[model samples]
Target: MSKKIREKKSTLFSLLFIAAVILLTLWSLSRAEDPDKLIKDIQNASPVFLVLAVLCVLAFICLQGVVIWLQCRSLKLQESLWRCVLVAFHGYFYCSITPMQSGGPPIQIYDLKKEGIHISVGTLIILMETFLFKVVLVILSLGMLLFGHRLMRRYIWPGLFFFILGTILTCGIVVLIYLSMFHSGLLRRLILWLFRKLEKHHLVRSKKGRVEKLISAMDKYRAAAGYFRNQRKLAVLLLAVTMLQRLAYFSTTYFIYRSFGLYGVSYWTIVLLQAAISICADMLPIPGGVGITEALFQVFFRDIFGTMTIPGLCLSRGITFYAQLLFCGIFSIAARVAFRVDKSRLGFFQTSFIVPEDAP
Candidate 1:
């Protein structure tokens, strides 16, 4: 199958995967002996806690978009904060749909391009956003492993090892491949290999017609990365901001737990699990890996959290993921409408080949 065709076909597999996860999670929840207790637990949750969750969630959504916005601006592409937020939300909305959850950014770029953004810049925005997020994940996962060694030994060593090994392997590959992109077809070959694997897995199939498109896009990415490479200071600043943004996200969860009058048992362990879950979800091809993430959270925290764990997990997930999904959608709709997006001028939807600052 053509790469695009294969990639497209993976959507179905992702849907099925998500369905399975949902079923398993529900069954697990049902067996909780006190499934009814969760509702009461939620009812008993502090309103202040809920409010704090929402606010922090909103901040996370904004920072998520802004991290990319800053990267775009660094590249001399400019989109309004409203535009950036819209892009981010619409991406999440799409992510919420498929298991392999990585499709949203490309969709966002496609949409943004229709709004008149340059395709190259849109691609850059998405690439930097993704790259920086991965880097931060590696950093955060490492920190938790180091500081929470005690808990890691008892509750999370297997998962932590899985995550750490995966992180190292993935980062090493990305670094080797991306750097090679500018020098030769080596990086392009790596992309093909990766995509081919996805295709083999029915994630993204091979598309002969798309070879040129994909290669050209990679060239643009290489160019953009080269530009960003020259700006060491900008790179540092962007990294710092993205790091802070992720830290803030974790802290929000921390405060939410705190507000619940709950304490102890390695909240940081939950944090690592969350990081690992998100990474795993990317491979699942389910939009945002919704069902998988929830299930994994329940499973991973089972030992640490006991019976009310699912509810706590759900409550936390509800306030965070669902909240971001909703808020970003509303914000994007309002912003797109207020800004008067001209579809024809922008181009319909397609993957971004560059950062999105040039969109509109």
Candidate 2:
């Protein structure tokens, strides 16, 4: 299919998914004795907590920029921090609309190329950032499984089996991606062997070009691995920053819980639940994990907090996902406008900063 058709389809699906999520959230609330009263209760909850929840969401957005900035600096890219922030918002806008966030990296790479970074470097930066992000996610989910298995069995749907399966799959994918960049000898042999088999079966016209591309990517990965290894301190700092980024993002749930004054579950337990939700969401094909998040929230919190699950879902999603979606969507548009204006003034040749040809 054409790109335009795919985009239109994605837009249509995103709209429908978002509507479904809204309806599901409403339905959850409607189960209450009085839905309006429950909303009123949420509104009447601690104002401080509400504000903190918003701040935490905002912090989450900013921390993504920090992760990119640090990784870019490690690669010797001199892009401005504001550019990183714009990239984060712009990526979020696309990611929120596309299924499984498949649209995000391309947009980010396009934006970075416009800023004068080479496409190759931009891709590496994104890959490194994504690797660290996935690492943090896998670690958090494993922590939940190890320390909160009882809660998982009791609350999460599909119980321990589902959680373990999802977490293992996610971690395995991440580990393979990481290993591909640094230790790809086995992967390269396997890929080449598969391509050779296809050629022998007359399935492919030519294997030479595709094999070259695979080798090129393997080289890029090796370079990235070596560069990062030489910058061990920066690598450690990037990991820590990524962890903080997730904590700030997930802490939105904690603040939202406090906003409703339901303290039955400890903060740690809530974090674990949020981690599980994230793991499940990754497994889902839905855009923004809309329906899946609502379903998981209901399943995970209902028995624990009774009717408070309704408000919890409402406030948690309202403050975190929906709020971020709306705000970042607008910010992305504004950034594009500003970038266009700046580009017009600077001319194409002057837009990008020169990097050393030999540098990774």
Candidate number of the best TM-score:
2
**Model 2 misplaced stretches (Cα beyond 4 Å):** 1-9, 184-222, 338-360
Error of 2 at 239 (Å): 1.0
* Model 1 C-alpha lDDT versus the unseen true structure: 0.63
| Whole-model lDDT values for every prediction | 0.63, 0.73
TM-score of model 2 (CA atoms) = 0.81
Tens-digit lDDT track of model 2 for 217-263? 55554555566657778879889988888888778777777777777
Model 1 lDDT at residue 340: 45
State the lDDT at 188 in candidate 2.
67
Quality of model 2 by C-alpha lDDT: 0.73
Off by over 4 Å in 1: 1-24, 144-148, 158-173, 180-221, 265-273, 279-282, 303-307, 329-360
Lowest lDDT sum, 10 consecutive residues, model 1, at: 343-352
Candidate 1 lands at a TM-score of 0.73
lDDT of 1 by residue, 1-360 (tens): 898798657656755655676567668776764767777777877888778767866776677678766765565444566677677777766576564455677777775566565565566667666667667776766666678577667655656544566567547745653455334356668876887788789887667777677777676766666666677787688788777676656655555565557778565655666666554444544466566566666666677566567667767677766666667667657755654455433322222454333433
Question: For residue 263, what is the lDDT in candidate 2?
Answer: 78
